[model samples]
Structures are given as C-alpha cells and as structure tokens.
Target: MLTWIALTALLLFSLATYMAGRRRAVAVTAGKPAQLHSLPGYYGSYAALWAGVPAALLILLFAMFGGRLEAGLLRVDPPAAVQELTAPQQDVFYDDARAIARGGTPSETIYDGALKTALEDKAAKSQQISSLIQYGSIGLGAILALAGVFIAYPRISPQFRARNKVEGWVAGLFVVCSVTAILTTAGIIASLVWESWRFFQAVPVHEFLLGTEWNPQIAMRADQFAGAGAFGAVPLFVGTFLIMLIAMMVAAPIGLFSAIYLSEYASPWTRSVVKPLLEILAGVPTVVYGFFAALTVGPLFRSFFNWIGAQLAGGSFDGLAQYLMQVQNQMALVAGAVMGIMLIPFVSSLSDDIINAVPQSLRDGSLAMGATRSETVKKVVLPAALPGIMAALLLAVSRAVGETMIVTMAAGLQARMTLNPLDTVTTVTVQIVTLLTGDQEFDSPKTLSAFGLGLTLFAVTLMLNIVALRIVRKYREQYD
Candidate 1:
C-alpha cells in the first residue's frame, strides 16, 4: 500500500513535469513555430516518459524481488532444536510465526520452549526489517525519478528529435512484449515434455499409445492386488473422436446453414435480431450447457432409444430391448449432442464473418454469366468461403476435444472402447482432471500421467491444426 501511494504521487508529479515541458517548448519557440523540433504534445509526452518510466520500472522490480531480499536479510542461525526439524516443519514454523506477527491467532500446538521465544523474536525482527526495506525502496525510486528528469530536461531543446526517441522506445517495448509471449509458450511446452518424459520412463510409451486397456489405477503397494497398471490410450482417443464426430454431425449442417441464411438470404431486420439470439449460445457458460446435457438432453435420448429398443424386441432382433435398456442418461451420445448445441454459435459467427468477406464482385460476375442466385451462392460464394468455413470447423473440433465439464457430467468415465455412442466412455481431458484433482506428489506415476496426457493432447491438437491449415491453403489457392 505504501508503494502504491508513492507510485501514485510519482505519476502526478510526472504529469506536472509534462505540462512544464510543453510550456518550455512553446517558450523556446519564442513566437516562432519554426524554432521547435517537435509538437508541444510530443515534447510533453517525452518529458512524462522520462519522469515516470524509470521509476515505475524500479518499483516493479522491487515488488517482484523485495520478498526474497527481505527473506535473505531476516535469516538468522536457528536454535539446535529448530535446526533438527525437517524442511517442511521449518516452513510451517516460519509460516505460523509470520501469520501471528500479522495479527492472526495461532491455532497449532504451542511451541512452549526456547523455540517459541526464538520465533516471536524472529517475527518481530522480520516486521521491523520489512518496513525499513519498503520505505527505503520508495526513497530509491524517488531519487531515480529525479535523476531521470535531470538527464532528460537538458535534451528537451529545439534541436533534440524527441519524437524519434519516443518512437524508438515504443518499438523496443513492442519487441519485449512479443518475446515475452514466445518465451512463455516455449516454457509451457518444455515443462509438459519434460514431465511427460518422466511419465514414459515409468510406463512404456508404445503401450500408452497402442494397447487396448487404460486402467490408470496403480497398486499403492506391490502386494495390493491391482495389476501393474495399463496406460494404453486407444480407448480415450477413440472416444474423443467418436464424440467429436457425433458433435460435427449435428453442428456442421445446422451452423453452416444458419450462417448462409444470415449472410445471404435473411432480411436486415431478421438478421439483426436472429444473429444476436443465435450468438447468445456462445456467451452461455459451459457449465450451464453441461447441466443442460446431463439433466435434460440425456433423459430425452434415453427415453427415445428405449422406445426404439422396445420396437426392436417384437422384430427380428428380439434381444435388443434388454441391451437398449442398459442405455442410460450418461453416455457419449448425450454429451456430444449437447456439445454440438454449444458449438453452433462459434461456427455460425465465424462462418458468417468469412462469408461476408467474400467479394461482391464474384457474385456479380456469376450472376452476369446467366447464373441464378442459388446457383451463384452454391458455386461461387461457397467455394470462395469454403477455406474459412473449414478453419472454423477445425477450431470447433479443437474446442470439443478439450471440453471437460460437459463430458464429465454427461458421459460416465468407463475406459472402454465401443462404437456405440450409447455406451459409457471417457476422454483424455476428463481423465486428466480426475488424475490431478487431489494433493499428490510427482514421485508417483498417477500424478505424472496427467502431464503425459497433456503433452499427447497438445501434440494431437497441433497436428490437427497443421493438417487443417494445409487443406485450407490447398483450397484457398484453387479459389484464388
């Protein structure tokens, strides 16, 4: 809070300096605009940047590293009893002391010896040291800010190109932002790959990819009876794709047809009202869609299939009713159907924008060649927009593959492969969530397997995106 107050004061001072610099620039002009090198506003901005930028950067650095610096400064040789405690025990002791010093009541067992006295003393010293560091850092920031103004004020003359300097700083800032994003992505992938390597060391990679079984429940002890767990991932891949296929079957035609009507055929009033209502599905939370799937769509499908099964009982397939009765509310079909409903807005909005981007000249040319409006739409406009539609569908597919809540709520987590959508199944995402929900150590394969699944999912999604981009490019060239 003190740092914030100091920074706010610095900002207000920078603004004042900016106004002073602008007035100085005007004074240097001396009733002649030609005497100035840059605009008054540009000079003002340059002065503000000089007055605040270095100090703001210093404050940011202090915020990030101040805790570590204080921790180092507060370190004192512990008593023999405290030194004998394990590392985690020491951490707990320090945590309690810090909390108590901050006015929190201690609930744990009292130390009751020299250890308690030592902790209280340490806490008091930490508080005193922390306050000194905070105030000192603010003073240092003020000094640096004043130094920056002294260095910058002299260069704010008529001959100095303030605009070029400001633009150079802006360019450097942009480069820093870009590099930060690139490095962040690299770090994420590297972490996933490293942890996945550890997982594969314990479980064979080939079995994980190919074998039929997927029992991730490992025996906690060798004598515990559950076999050395199987990690075969085929069932998960199959189920993921199966649900995704069902979703596309429902979403593709409906979303595409809606996009076409809205883009080409709908009246202005109808499009304005209907488009927002349709896009509202996109804004509806995924958890609500999950509930809709589990509570509403699941039962409707169960009832429909049960009736069909009853019909099949009197027919040649007399034993099918017993099988269909097993089809319950929680299955891949229910999840996929509801997921398709959730995906419609993504498809519609993207496809509508892409269709609108198709050149009016192409439609006009097709019509001039004696083509009907429907013929022009089918042949010229659609072909032109097909690449973008395919890209949208691929994005929707990626979304479906990554979805968890709807699948968890609507599809029971039975790791078995079945072509029948009525059968229970689980996806990679659902299993990853299940595996990593609790506090578990990375020493066990069960916890590390989540990272393995994440890497595999990332690789598969990357390949899918690459293939989609290739197909889009191939068609785009033909259209061009």
Candidate 2:
C-alpha cells in the first residue's frame, strides 16, 4: 500500500515536471515554438522520462528485494529461544514473526512461554525494520526523482536535442528487454540441467532412457511394503510419440486441406465466415476440450467400436472382436482426436496466411501455361508455400507433444508402451504434472525426475525445431 501511494505521488510529480519543462522551453525561446530545435512536447517527455525512470527503478528494486533484506537483517541477531531451535525450526520461528508483523496468519504450531515471548519481540523488531526500509527507500527515490528534474528541466533550451536523448533512452529500454528475455531462457535451461543432473545421480541415465517401466513411487523407509520405483522413460517416450502421430494423422491433412480450400477455392464471403468459425476452435480452453473429450468423443468412439465388435463377435474375427469389445472410453485415439480438433485452428490459420502469401503472379503464370486451377495449386502455390506449411505442421506437433489436460482427461494415465491407439496411454507432460502435483521433496528422485523428463522433452523439441528449420531453409532457397 505504501509503495502504491509512492508510485502515484511519483507519477504526479513527473507530470508536473513535464509541464514545467515544456513551459520553460517555450519561455527560453521567447514563446516562439519555431526557435526550438525539437518540439516543446519532446522537452516535456525528456523531463518526464528522467524524473520517472530513475525513481521507478529504485521502487522496483526495493519492491523485489526489500523483504529478503528485512529477513536477513532480522536473522543477523536472533533471540536466545530461536537460537536453541534446529535450523528448520528457526526458519519457522522467523516466518511466524514476519507473518505476525504483517498481520497475516502463520503456521498452525502453537507457541507458548519463552518461544512466544521471543516471537512477540521479534515481530516488533521486524515491523520496525520493515518500515525503516520502506520509508528510507521511498525517501531516496524521491530525492533521485527531484535530482533528475533539476538536472533535466534547466537544460530545456533551443538547442538541447531533447528528442535525441529521449530516443536514446527508448533504445536502451528495448535493449534491456531483449537481454531480460535471453537471460530468462538461459536461466530455465540451466535450472533444468542442474536438477536433471541430480536426478541422474540417483537413477541411472541408461535405465531412465531405455528401461520399459515408469513407476516413480519409492518407499520412504526400509520396511515399507511399496516396491522400489522403476524410472524407465521408454514407455513415456513411446506413448508421447504414439499420441503425437495419431494427432498429426488427424490434424495435418484436415488443417492443410482447410487452408488450401480457404485460400484457393472459397469465395471472399465464404472465407470470411468459415475462417473465423474454424479459428474459434483455437480460442476454446484446453480444459473445455478435455471435458468435451471425456464426456462426448470418448463415449461416442467407444460405442461405435463396441457396435463393430458385436457384429464380429460370432464371426471368424472372434479374437479381434474380444479385443475391440474391451476397448475403454479413455484411449489414445480419443485424446488424439480431440487434441487434433483443438490444433486445427493453429495449423489452418498459419497455413492459410502462408498460402495466401504466395505471389499471385505464379498462379497467373501457371494458368497462362493452360494449367487448371487444381494443377496450379498443386504445382505453383503449394510448392511456394511448402516451407511455411512445414513450419505450421511443426508448430502443431509441438502443441500436441506439450498438451496435458486433454490427454489427462481423455486418455487414462497408464504408462504402457504400445502403438495401438485403442489402448490407454500417458504422455511425458502428464507424468511430469503427476510427479510434482502435491508437496514434494526436491531431494527425492521421484520429484527431481520431473526435471529429467522436462530436459528430455526440451531436447526432443529442440531437435525437431532444428530439423524443421533445416528443411525450411532448404526449400526457401529453391523458392526464392
């Protein structure tokens, strides 16, 4: 609340500084705007940026790190009662004190006697330290903002080059944003590698990569009845690809053909209507798709297959009939079909844009050679759009590989290595969610295995992207 008030005050101050700078610029030029090197608004914006940027940076820094600094200062000199507790207990004690200071609820552990007294004393100290940091930072930020106004407002003259300075600041802000994104990606990859390395220390890399089973629930103690965990990731990889293949089988052709028709055969009115209706499927939530899969498509497919099985029950295909009869609502086929329906918009939208991007001159030239519309589309437009179509398919494959909710709801979480789409299966993403769903100890192989799975998925996705990029580049050269 204090920070928000400070921010609001700083905003108002910056606005005031902007007006002062603009007025000063016009006054220095004898109220003749033509005499200024840049517009009066540029001088105002320059002053506003200087007043806001430094102070905003200070506020952001304090907001991000103030609590940690407060905690560190509080822990520098602990109470005797807190010193007597174990490390974890001391952490809890500090947490309780901080919570009390902030008027928030702490842990359920009831405190009494010396510990309770110590908590109260520490809470008071914490509150004092927190206020000191908050007020001190706000005060320092106000001083910096005032300093910026003094430094910038006096420089508002005819030859001040305010626009160039403002552009430089904007350029620096863009550079900062680009660096932040790169650093964020680097941090994610590094954390995944470090945690996956720890998991590999407990579970052999070869076993995780090649072994067939994937039960990750290990017994917590020696005498427990639970079996030792199996960490084979082959089943996960198989199921992931099996479902991906099935989804692509349903998505690729349909989405591509839809794009082709929309771009080539459909009239403008038809395209306008059908395009958004198809793209509407993209905006639907994945959870909703999951529910649709579970409630509607799964049962519909099961009934249709069961009817087929009944027809073949007493025939020569009795064995096949029994297998088909046993098929459940939750299977790879249902999930893949639903996921494909979900991906149709992604492929269709991107491919439609790509196909339309092909030069009209190519189609005209093909027609000038007496080729039919279909022949022109097959030979000229499709070849020109092939690279972008491949990219769109790659994007769809990535979506399918990363999907979880639909697979979780429609496909039962059974980690079995089978290509049969009729069987229940699970994907790596679903297992990752399962492994880390509840409170989990990071030291345990079961929890750390999520990172291992994530790393593997990341590697596969990267390799697929590399391959796709190479294919795209190769085709692009020919087309260009």
Candidate 3:
C-alpha cells in the first residue's frame, strides 16, 4: 500500500511540474524576453521538483530504516531486575516482551520473578513509545511540506530566478542517482567481506582454501566436537568445475555453431525468421529448465541407456542392470547436455552481434581476393571476433558455475570430489542455498557457511570477469 502511494505521489508530482512549467513558459513568452524578470515554466518546475523529489527520498529512507530506528530507540536497558539473566537469556526475554506486546506469548522459559514482571511492563512502554514516534514523524513531515509550499509559492513570480535554480537541482539529482548505484554495490561487497571475516575466525583461512574435504556438518552443541566440519572446500570447487565443464560442453559448441551459421550462412530471410526464435530461448525461466532437467532430461537419459543395454543384451535387461552395464544415469553428460541447450542462445546471440559488428570491408576484402565465404569467415572475420567469442564463453561458464536451480533440481546434492562426470555431485551455489534456506540460526556455523560459499563464488566470478575484460581489451587493441 505504501509503494502504491509513493508511485501515485511521484506521478502526480511529475505531471503537475510539467503542466506548471508549460504555463510559466506561456506567461514569459506573452511578454518580451527583456521585459520578463524570469521564465514562468521555471518557477512551476521548481515547485514540482522540490515537492516530489525530497518526499520520494524521505519515503525510501523511512521504508529502509524505520524498523531499525524504532528498534534502536526502544533498546533501553531492561530494568535492573532482568540483568541477572545471561546474554542469551536476556535476548530471549526481550523477544518474549516484544511478542507479548503484540498479543503473542513466547514458548521459551520466562524466568519467573522481577524479570517476567519487568518484561510485561517494558512491552507496554515500548508499544506506546513506538506509536508516539510514528505519529510525531508524520506530523513533522506534514508541517515541513506545508513550509516548503509556502516558500515555493512566493517565488513563483515573474521576477523570480526559478529556472536556473531548478535546472541546477535537476543536475544535482542526476548525480545523486548515479552515486546511489555505486554506493549500493560497495555496501554489498562490504557486507560480504565482514561476514567472510567472521567465518574465517571460526574456520582457518588455509583450511578453507587448501583443505580437500568439504563436509559441513557440525554438532549442535559447542562443547561437542564439530564432526565433519572439515574446512576443505576443494570437493565443492571440483564439483563446481566439473558441473560447469559439463554445461559448457553442452552450450559452447552448439551455441557457437548456431551463431556462425546464423551470421555467415543464413540468408537475410532466414536470419529474420530464426533470430527471434533463438533469442526466445533465453526468456524461458530457469526454474522451468530445472524441472525439465530433473523430470524430463534425467529420466530420458536413463531410459536411453536402458534401451542401449537391452539392445546389447538381447532385450533381457532390467533398468538398473542396463544403466550399470551400458551407461551412468547421473553422469555429467546429462547435466552438461541440458546446460548446453540453455546456453546456446546466450552464446549464439552474443557471438552473432560481435560477428555482425565485424566490418563488411574485411569480408569484402577477403572475398575479392578469391577466398571462399567459409575461408573469409574463418581466416578474417572469426579471427577478429575470437576475443569477443572467448569473453562470451567465459561469461557463459561463470553463469553455469553459479547456476543453482538446474543443478539443485537435477544434479544430486552430494558433495563428491570425483572427476567422473557420471557421478552425482554439487556446486557452491547449491550448497549455499541448502545451507541457508531454513529456520536456521544466523550465528550458527551452518548459516555462516553460506556467507563463506558466497564470498568464494563472488571472488571466482570477479576473477573471471577481470580476465575476460583484459582479453577483450587486448583483442580490441589488436584490431584497432
């Protein structure tokens, strides 16, 4: 509801601004430029931008920080009566108080005595305080808005220098919007860095980086040994590479061949018909691909192997026997094949654009020298576009590695370090998703593991992008 209100307010404010500026322009134009003190439209726009932009920013700020602000304000020291409880117990007490305020009771043991009585008292006080703060803020906002209107109205005069002021304000807004995006990216990186630092405190950095085992299971009690908390993330890395390789094997050749055929071989009419159809492949939701992998592709591969076995064994073989005798159902082949299908359009479309961007002069030069079309494409055009193609393939590999749904649904969740493509395995993203997707405590090693996985994934993707950018730069320089 607040989102709708904000949207409505922004639209109304913008429209009013446009109309006001238009009216002001007419008034200024009615007289000579020298006779006019200032442009009329400028005054109207000044009022509109001032009214809309600040209010929108306030709404955004409130939505982001309101709960935290309220929590901060109400974080009073629990009456001395509750001080005897341990830190965890105090947390429990505070949670209970908040729940009680909302007409709910907590299931945790409420230490009977002053602690319980104080909790009930504090709950009422916190609720009243929160209500007062909310009402006061709304009143303040309304008063400020009225003041802004009063200040703006008197300046909406013929002599007012509203145009210059408003233009300057608009330019400032543009800069702020750009800065906001940069700040958001920095904020995400900072948060990941902090969390990964905490994880490293619990698990040694070397163990995480160079250890070979990846068993993440830990005992619930801190006093007990953390069984299988082996920090060796090598198996996860191996699985990530293996799965990515399988997917790339499927996607790269098919996508590249499709791109080459579309760019160099297709007639104009065929290109027109086929390009949109190929692009449509990208629009298919990844979850759909996940289901297709698990329900359709996986079973189909298993069936194909069974059939192959039956043919080889005079039709006397069972499914499992056939699979064992002829083929592996969970081999990297199935997952890679499906992943390749998903990537075909991504590679083909990117490759096609780069190929098309190759100057016609080069192609014409090669053809004029009595070179065949294939020879021209291979020797001149493909060579020129190879760097871009490699960049695209690298990007596809990154996507495949980070992909969660396809692997989670089809690729078995086991964290096996085997190089065999036929063996079921998992990737970092899959482990991260499973680790964090439940009623898990935030401070637990299990939950914290997700952040470690995320940090690693981020680093890997970042490195790949850097390499691709460098390669692209080198290629661009060569051609230039």
Candidate 2 per-residue C-alpha lDDT over 1-480 given as tens digits, one digit per residue, 9 for 90 to 100: 999999999999999989988888899999798999999988998999989889988997998899999999999877787799999998999999999999999999888999999999999999999999999999999999999998998888899999899899999989999999999999999999999999898888998998899888754754433233488999999999988988999899999999999999999999999999998889999999999999999999999899899999989999999888888999999999999989988999989988987888899999999999999999989988988899889978988998999998998889998999999999999999988888766788888889999999998888777877786667657646
lDDT of 3 by residue, 1-480 (tens): 544464475658566765765465556556554444555556667777666666556555665676567566656765887777788777777777667776886756846677767877878876776566555554454455445555675565566677688879979979999999999999999988888888788888888877888777644665554444476778888988998888888788889988999999999999999999998999898888888888888888877766666666645556545555555445555666777788889999988987887889999999999999999998999988999999989989878878888878777777888887767888888889888886766666667777888999999998898888787778767655
Q: How much lDDT does candidate 2 score?
A: 0.91
lDDT of 3 at 368: 100
Reference-based lDDT, residue 157, model 2:
87
* Candidate 2 residue-wise lDDT at 305: 90
Per-candidate Cα lDDT values, in order, are: 0.84, 0.91, 0.76
Ranking the candidates on TM-score from highest down gives 2, 1, 3
Per-residue lDDT of model 1, residues 298-331, tens digit only: 9999999888888787677867877886689989
Error of 3 at 305 (Å): 3.6
Predicted structure 3: lDDT: 0.76
Residue pairs of candidate 1 with colliding backbone atoms: none
Q: What's the true lDDT of residue 291 in model 2?
A: 99
